[model samples]
Target: MSTAQATTTHDEIVATVTGIVAQELGVPAESLAPDADLRSVEGADSVKVLRMIAKVEREYDVELEDEQVFAVNSIDGVATVVLDTLAQDAA
Candidate 1:
C-alpha cells in the first residue's frame, strides 16, 4: 500500500483531517486548531460535517461508528477516533 494508504501517525491524521475539514468548510487548514470545534465554525452544518467524515473515511479506509462520528466536535477528536478505528481493524 502507498504511504498515504497505510496507517499513519496521529499528527499526520490530524493534518489530513484538518485539510479535509478546511476544504469542506471553505476555511484555511492552518486556521483550524487541533482542538477547534468544527460545529462552531462559520457555515458549518450537519451535511458538511457528514461530508467531511465521508472524506476522512475514504482517506483512511476506516469506517467509524455513527455515535462516534456525531460525537466528534474537534479535529483532535476525529483523529483520536480514526486512530481507534484503525487499531480495531489491525486487531
Candidate 2:
C-alpha cells in the first residue's frame, strides 16, 4: 500500500481498537489515545488487558501470539501488531 493508504488503514484500526478497549474496560472512548498506557488506566489489570487482547483478536479474526500481546504497552503498539498480522495474512 502507498504511504497514505497505510496511514489511513492504521488510523482506522486504531480507532476501532480504541473503541473496543473503551467498551470492554468501561472507560470513555475519548479517554483512550494511540499513545496511552493501557496498564496505567484505572481498573485495568493483567487479566483485563489479556481479555481486551482476546476481544481484539476475535474482532479482527487474527490470533496474536502471547509474547507480542504481552509486549504491547500502548494502543499504537496493538494497532501495529494487528495491522502487521492482517498484512501477513493477506500475503
Candidate 3:
C-alpha cells in the first residue's frame, strides 16, 4: 500500500466502514451513525454483516479474525479493529 493508504486516519476508516455497511445493508451512508449498533439496524443480519466485513477487508487489504468481526457491533468498533490490524502490519 502507498503511504496515503497506509496512513489512513481513524475517522477515515470509520467512514469507509460505514459506507461498506450501508452498501451491504442497502441503506444510505448518511443514515448510519458511527456508534449505532449494526446488528440492530433494520434489514441487518449475520450474512449482511459478514458481507460488510468482507468488503471492508478488501478495501483495507487486511484479514480480520472472525471473533473480531462478530465482536464489532458498530462502525467505530470496526474502524478500531481495522486500525489496530493496520498498525500491527506497520510494526
Candidate 4:
C-alpha cells in the first residue's frame, strides 16, 4: 500500500464513503450506518447508486471492478473493495 493507504483504517474509509453516499443520494449521513444497504435507502435506485460509487471512486482515485462494485450493497462493502484495490495497487 502507499504510505497513506497503508495507514487508512476501515472506519475512516466507511466515514468518507458514507459522506459521499449521503451527498449523492440526498440522504443524511447520520442515517447511513456502515452496514446500511444502499439499495434499501429511500429514493435510491441503481443509477443513483452507481453515481455515488463513481463519486467515491474519484475521491479515492481507485477504479473498482464492476463485479466488485455491484456485488456490494453497503458502505462497508464499498470500503472493503476500495481497501482491497488499494492493497492490490500497493502490491
TM-score, per-candidate, Cα-based: 0.91, 0.87, 0.94, 0.92
Candidate number with the higher TM-score (1 or 2):
1
Between candidates 2 and 4, name the one with more favorable TM-score. 4
**Model 4: residues >4 Å from true position, as ranges?**
none
After superposition, the stretches of candidate 1 with alpha carbons farther than 4 Å from their true spots are 1-7
Query: What is candidate 2's lDDT per residue for 1-91, written digit by digit as tens?
Result: 3453344478888998898889878999898878989999878899988888988888777899988887889989999998998888666
Candidate 1 lDDT over residue span 1-91, tens digit each? 3455455889999999999999999998889999989999888998999999999999988889999998879999999999888877776
Clashing pairs in 4: none
Worst 10 residues of 4 by lDDT: 1-10
Question: Would you list the clashing residue pairs of candidate 2?
Answer: none
Q: If ranked by lDDT, best first, what sequence of candidates would result? A: 3, 1, 4, 2
TM-score ranking, best first = 3, 4, 1, 2
> Better model by lDDT, 2 or 4?
4
Per-residue lDDT of candidate 3, residues 3-86 (tens digit) = 966889999999899888887888999999999999998899988888888999999899999888888799999999999999
For model 4, residues 1-91, the per-residue Cα lDDT tens digits are: 3477677878889999999888887889999999988999988999999999989888777899999998999999999999888888777
Which candidate comes out best when scored by TM-score? Answer: 3
Clashing pairs in 1: none
Off by over 4 Å in 2: 1-8
User: Distance from true position, residue 41, model 2, in Å?
Assistant: 0.6
Give lDDT for model 3: 0.90
Residue 31 of model 1 has an lDDT of 90
